[model samples]
Target: MNSTKGSMINEKKGRIGCVKWHGDLMDTRTFSNAGQDLYVRVNETILAQYAKSSGSLTKKAKLAISIVSVLLFFLVVFLVYWLAKRKSKGKERPDKFVSRVLTGSTYFEKSTADLDDENTINSSELPFFNLSTIYVATNNFSASNKLGTGGFGSVYKGVFSNGKEIAVKRLSKHSGQGIEEFKNEVVLIAKLQHRNLVRILGCCVQDEEKMLIYEYVPNKSLDYFIFNETNRALLDWTRRIFRGDQNEANTNRVVGTYGYMSPEYAMEGLFSVKSDVYSFGILLLEIISGRKNTGYYNETYPDSNLVGHVWNLWGEDNALKIVDSSLVDSFHFNQVARCIQIALLCVQEDPTERPTMSAVLVMLSNDAALPQPGKPPFLVKKSGTIEDNSINYVTCTIVSTR
Candidate 1:
């Protein structure tokens, strides 16, 4: 009988635990629904006593507790905000990440759709370089050390005391470019370890001087070769033709020249990874023909640019006629034909039809069957003047004529 009574008391205690406060302070109600009703009854007495004590606490003490809780909440919020801001500010530019993606310096999205927020970069390790160090490296911008000029500014060759050769691209004050492009190039190229593309070592932003430092190419650009007859022979025997395709080889072997600029880049400047593919095609043609694209030839092929001449020879089933005489005996006819076809494909008027760099690599590497190229634009001879209808800077307007 005593054990039964103890069980009854325990059951009663559990029933009182279910009650919950509801409604406003002055008009509160207790909820008691189903299983929850059991606890409300079991814990009622204990809860009433606790409530009585809680109701009598001094308002000042209650206010103090509230203030402390609010302070604690804000402190946590502030800390999180501060940390996030610092992290975002710490992120590096996107170009570096692009380079990393390209060169396999880092493995990431294989396609455009795969890019996600998580693959962000941390900021540059060196925020900025001292102007004095840059001046010392460039020999205070000596004329003899000058490399070349671009839209952004003049590039100068620099050699550090440690035997590191560098190209310093110094931006002009009123140049149309911005810090963003420089940062983009730096972050992109630094991570990209491609043998074909140039490498960016570092950058310097001091007062008015915004300079980008790159690894020096001893022979400089491809323009040095394809633009003149004397220099064009360096590409003789089509050694440069084969050399340009080794995008995965030594960094020094990559070709970049002026007359060798791909039709897409020269016409539209709509560059992608394939822009280099197009460039390689032009360079290959220049090597084989020993001719420059922009140079004036006879009127029969007055529209006869280098690419057009090669195309004409290919159509007549006499592609060998275009090959330089210097390598007539040793040059592989099959290899030369395939290269010319690939070059023509790269210079196609329609950008959409152009093969990607990876595709070009495959075509060059294997015995894969290549596609027939469409007739290129500027195929016909024009009388008198030729107009460049390219877009203008700042306004970005395209000038069209009848």
Candidate 2:
């Protein structure tokens, strides 16, 4: 009974004890009190043999587990690297997009990364106009159909078989503005719904052909009438005289037409909504007086520009003297005088003195006291040349990567 109690105590303590059956001997393994192996068998000789053989077997099993763990760790790392590489390799390049546009596909299919169901089409919308259609429309770009040239390229008028009038400004092969202007006009005009500005209907970029399509203004640009004496007379309310200057390089120094450029813009290249205001001022004066801002000449008043001359007349309260005699017959003196004041204010040398388009529109629509304008720019000298007042003519060019 005492041995049975000792064995029960050893079992509870997890001491290894062997149960020897009649045929096969089964060993029950447990830890010793000191945490060493506790082996119990029939004899000491059996225990010694078992301990020696199990040592090498246990070491081999541990080695197999370590090898499997290392292999699994390496396999996981390799899979992660391969997945990252695949993701990076799938990224689309800009050149690839350009090539796609050049391929002449009728329908443009956007990449999954480029668009989705909630896709908002900005200027970068796929499926642009076909090059073949534009070529056929322009009569293979005949010289006779050419209208006017610009910084980017030449404008050609095209009449489609359906009698659709279209003007295509084909981008020059060497033009720097083609890509950027294409994107800018597309994005800007798409969102801006304005009446005064020329409307851009659509654009096309196919096989290196970048073109902008605008709603054709039948009267053409304001320059057509403002620059020529005969043409100026046409706009002078009936039959009256009007007069213009600038070189090509100086012309392109600023955006917009030559005679139409504000003195501030022509000299300083300072542009804003006010810049357009300055242009509109020049146009207004040309329309009223039938005289060009850049072309007026008089020996008596060597410093007489259209703006300066108008300012003198306004001060004398004889501003009506400058108004074309033909317009005098049918024109409202009150409206004409107010328009002259507004034009003079717009042409002021100081940009801060000019009003925004909204403000200008308001002032024109209502009777409001305008602030006195500062000195107008391009104060004409003895010669009919425009003088630049600003220092840095070449401003930094903004480039878009995408």
Best by TM-score: 1
> Which stretches of model 1 miss by more than 4 angstroms?
1-127, 173-196, 242-276, 325-330, 366-369, 378-402
TM-score of each: 0.55, 0.54
The 10-residue segment of model 2 with minimum total lDDT is 393-402
Per-residue error (Å), model 2, residue 339: 1.0
1-402 in candidate 2: lDDT tens per residue? Answer: 012111212344556564333444245445454444433334556656778899989999999999999999999999999999888666534334433433433222333242222222233434234566667778989999887876557788876555566777777888655555444444444434344344444456655577765544443444565456565545544222111121111111223445556556566566577876786677667667766665564456666777778777777778877786546566778878887888888888777888887887797789888776666766654453333322222211111111
All candidates' lDDT scores? Answer: 0.57, 0.57
Candidate 1 is scored at a TM of 0.55
Cα lDDT, model 1, residue 155: 76
lDDT of 1 by residue, 36-74 (tens): 222123245656777787777767689999999999999
For model 2, the superposed segments whose C-alpha errors exceed 4 Å read 1-127, 174-196, 236-271, 301-304, 366-371, 381-402
lDDT of 2 at 73: 100
* Clash count list over all predictions: 25, 4
lDDT of candidate model 1 versus the reference: 0.57
